[model samples]
Target chain A: MNGTFDPPATGKRVIPGTYVFDGDAARRGFAINEMCFSFNEDANRRAFAEDEEAYMERFHLSEEHKKAIRERDVIGMLNAGGNIYYLAKLAGILKLGVQDIGALQTGTTVDEFKAALLAHGAKLKELQTQGETA
Target chain B: MSTIAGGIFTSHVPGIGQAIAKGLKQDPYWKPFFDGWHTVHDWLKREKPDVLVCFYNDHGLNFFLDKLPTFAIGAADGYRHEDEGWGISGYKPYPGMPELSWHIIEQVVHDEFDPTMCQKMLVDHALAIPVEMAWPDEEESWPFKLVPIAINTVQYPLPSPKRCFEFGRSVGRALESWPGDEKIVVMGTGGLSHQLEGERAGHINIEYDTFCMDNLSRDPEALLQHSSLDIAELAGSQGVEILNWIAARGAMRGSVTELSRNYHIPISNTAAATMLLENHETVLA
Candidate 1:
C-alpha cells in the first residue's frame, strides 16, 4: 500500500499540530498499522518485544517504519502513516499511556502535559461557575 | 410494540475501565465522574429495559484496518470482551438479543441504510465500559440483553453525523414497529472531546461539549451544521465520537426530555459526560 504519498484533495484544510490520517496516510502506514494491530494478542506482543527487528521483518515494514518504531517516535510514526488508534497498541507494549505519547509528540515533559490538562479542566470549572452565578 | 425507553449518552474512555477495576471510583480525581452515574443507576433500575442498543465505536478490538465497515450491527447471541493489547482486564461476555438485532438490521436495510451484519462480533471498551459503569454490581451477568451497533470512528472517511443520525432514526422506526412487549434503551457511548494523537493530544473543548449536551436533546439538528471536518477541528480528532451520541439522540422519536446530565473534565484527558433522555410519547405500531 506504499508508494507515492498523494496528498488529500486541495479543499481539505490542514490543522496545525494535527494529522488527519486520511487515505494517503492510511496507505503509507498500512504496514505499521497492520503490525500494531497484531499486538492485540499477547503472544504477538511477546514476539515483538522479544525481537523488534524480526517482528518488523515478519510484517514487511519499510525501513522508515522500522526506524520510527525503533526510536519510539509517535510523530514520526504518524508521518509514516501510523494511525493513533492502531499505534496505541504498540504504545501499550512499550508501557506508554496516551499522556506519555502526548508529551512525546508535543515536546513536553509528562508532568507539564498533565499540568496543561489540569489547567484546561480548571478553566472549564471557572466557566461553569460563572455560568451558574450569572 | 416495543417501547423506546430513552437514550443514555456517555464518554467511554478506557481509563474508566481501569478506574473501576482498581476500585478508584471514590478517589478525589474520579469522584465527580462516578457521582454522575447515580441518576443513571436509578433510572436504569426503575425503567428495567429488556435490551440495550449500543451505539459505539470499536478501538481495534473487533475489526482491523483490512476491511473496516462504515456501520456494523452485531447479530450474535452474545458478545465477548477480549484483551485489547492494553493492560485493561477483560469483562464477562454480555448476553445478546440476536432476534432483535436481526430485526433492526433487516428494518434498517429495508429503509435503505446499509450496514454490515455480524452474527459474531467482539465488543471493545467503547461498548463494555459504559455497561460496566451503568451496572456496576452486575458482574456475573447484566440484566439487559445487548444489540451492538458499531460505527467506524477509527478510520478516515467516517460516516457523517447526519448519516449516523438518520441511520439511528431508521433503527428507531424499526424498534417502534416491532411487535413485542419489551422496553428498549439505546446508548451512545463516546466523547465530549479529547485528542490522543499529534501535538494536539491533550485537547479539550468545553464550549463544544456544553453546546452538545445542551442541544442533543432539545435540538440535535443544530449539530449537523458542522461537517465532520468541522467536528474534528472543534472537538479534536478523537472527539468525533460524538457521532455516536448524535445517533443515539436520533433513536429517540417523539418529544424528548433531558432527565439528568453530568459533565466533568480531565477524566483521562477527556471531558467525560453522562446524560439521560426520555421519550415521552408512545407510538402505536
Candidate 2:
C-alpha cells in the first residue's frame, strides 16, 4: 500500500437500482435463507418438492415466508427479508432462475427484463456523452 | 523477489460449474462461454505460474451473517470445497501456500489494509466454481498453489472499489519484496454486470461490462472513480463483485499485455466474462 488505504465507507445511499441484502435484511431473511440453503442436499430438495408446506415448516419459516413460497412472489419474498442468493435456492426449487425473479419483481417478461437491462447501458452512454460535452 | 507475473478476471457463477461438471460445453447455451476459456487454459499451461492469489466471495459456506469479514485471507494448509447446499460435491483438495499467504498478509496489514486473517476456511462455489471451470480434472490436485482472498460481496458495506484496488497493490508490493523466486498470478473471480436481487435483478449491462473490461487492461484507475453504488447503478447489486476484478487489475501495476477477452450473456441470469493479462515487463523481461 503506497498511501494509507481507507476502509469501506459506512452508511452510503443504497443506489437507486438495488435492494441491498444488508444486516437488517439478513436478520429478517435468516429463516427463509436457511430454508433455501437446505436445498443443497438432494433429499432436502426432494422433500421440498414433495411437500412445500412441510418443508418450509421444518425450516420454521414465518407465515410471510409460507405465503411468499406459496404465491411464488419474488418481491414478496424479498420484502419479507429474502436475500436473493438464498432466495435463489428457493427459486431453483420453483424452477425460477434469478432472471425470472427480476422479471417478476420488475413486472416484465424475462425477455423484456433482459432487454431493459441491456437498454440501460446505452442510456448510460448517452448520459456520459452529454456530461462530457457539457 | 517473487514476481507478480499476471492477472486474470473471471466470473465464478455456480451454474457454469454445473454446466462444466455435466459436460455441457458443446451445449449451445454453454459453447460460447467455454469457447472463451480455451485461450485461458492455454495461457495457464504456457505461463505455469507457481501460485494464484485468488480473490473470491464466499456464498453461504464459511462465514454467513453472524460474522462477515469485509476481507479475509486464507493461510490454511489446504482448502476443502463446501457442499454449498446444492448437492454439488467431490473435488480434490486445493493446496494453500501458507508461507506466501502470511508474507502478503503481514505486508497488507502493515500497509493498513485491515483484512481478517483465516487459519482455515472451507471455500464455497465462489472459489471452487472458478477453479473447477479452469481445471476440470477431478483426479489431480490443481497445479498452482492458492492464496484465497475472500471478499464480502454478500453483505452491505462491502469494500469500496478503490480500497480493493489498494489491497491488491499491497499484495503486489508484498510479492515483490519477498525474497523468494516464485512466479505469482493474481486471479480475481467475480462479476461482469449481473444483478441477482431486487427489482433490478436480471440486470446485465453489456456496455458497462465492456467499458469496464476494456479499461481493466489499460486504465484500471478509471474504474476506481466509480463507487460501489455507481457500479450497482450500472451493473446489478451482485455485479458489484467487479471490485474483485478491479483489484486484480491493480495488482498489475506494470504494463499488461491482454491475452484474451470473452463475454457472454445469460449465464444463469448474469453476463459472464473472462480476461487474461500477462505482465508485459515480467514475461518479456
Query: Which number leads on lDDT?
Result: 1
**Highest TM-score against the true fold, candidate:** 1
| lDDT for residue B120 in candidate 2, whole number 0-100 | 86
Tens-digit lDDT string for candidate 2 (B1-285): 677778878998888877877889999878878888888788777777888888888877787666779889999999998576666778778889899889989999999888889998998787787877776654666888889988888887678899999988888888788798878888898898887766556777777787887788888888888878788888888889898887777777777888888777667777788888888554454
Q: Which pairs of residues clash in candidate 1, taking residues 3 or more apart in a chain or in different chains?
A: none
Docking class of 2: acceptable
lDDT tens digits, residues B1-285, model 1? 788998899999988988998899999999999999999999999999999999999988899888799999999999999888985655878899999898999999998998999988999999989999998888578899999999988888888999989999999988888888899999999998989888778989888888888898899998988877789989999999999998888888988989999988899878899998998675567
What C-alpha lDDT, on a 0 to 100 scale, does residue B236 get in candidate 2? 82
> For model 1, how big is the CA root-mean-square deviation?
3.0
Clashing pairs in 2: A40-B85, A40-B86
Flag regions of model 2 displaced more than 4 Å.
Answer: A1-17, A37-61, A108-134, B136-139, B280-285
Candidate 1 stretches with Cα past 4 Å from truth are A1-11, A132-134, B282-285
TM-score of 1: 0.96
| Candidate lDDT values, in order | 0.88, 0.78
Error of 2 at A93 (Å): 3.5
Which candidate has the highest DockQ of all?
1
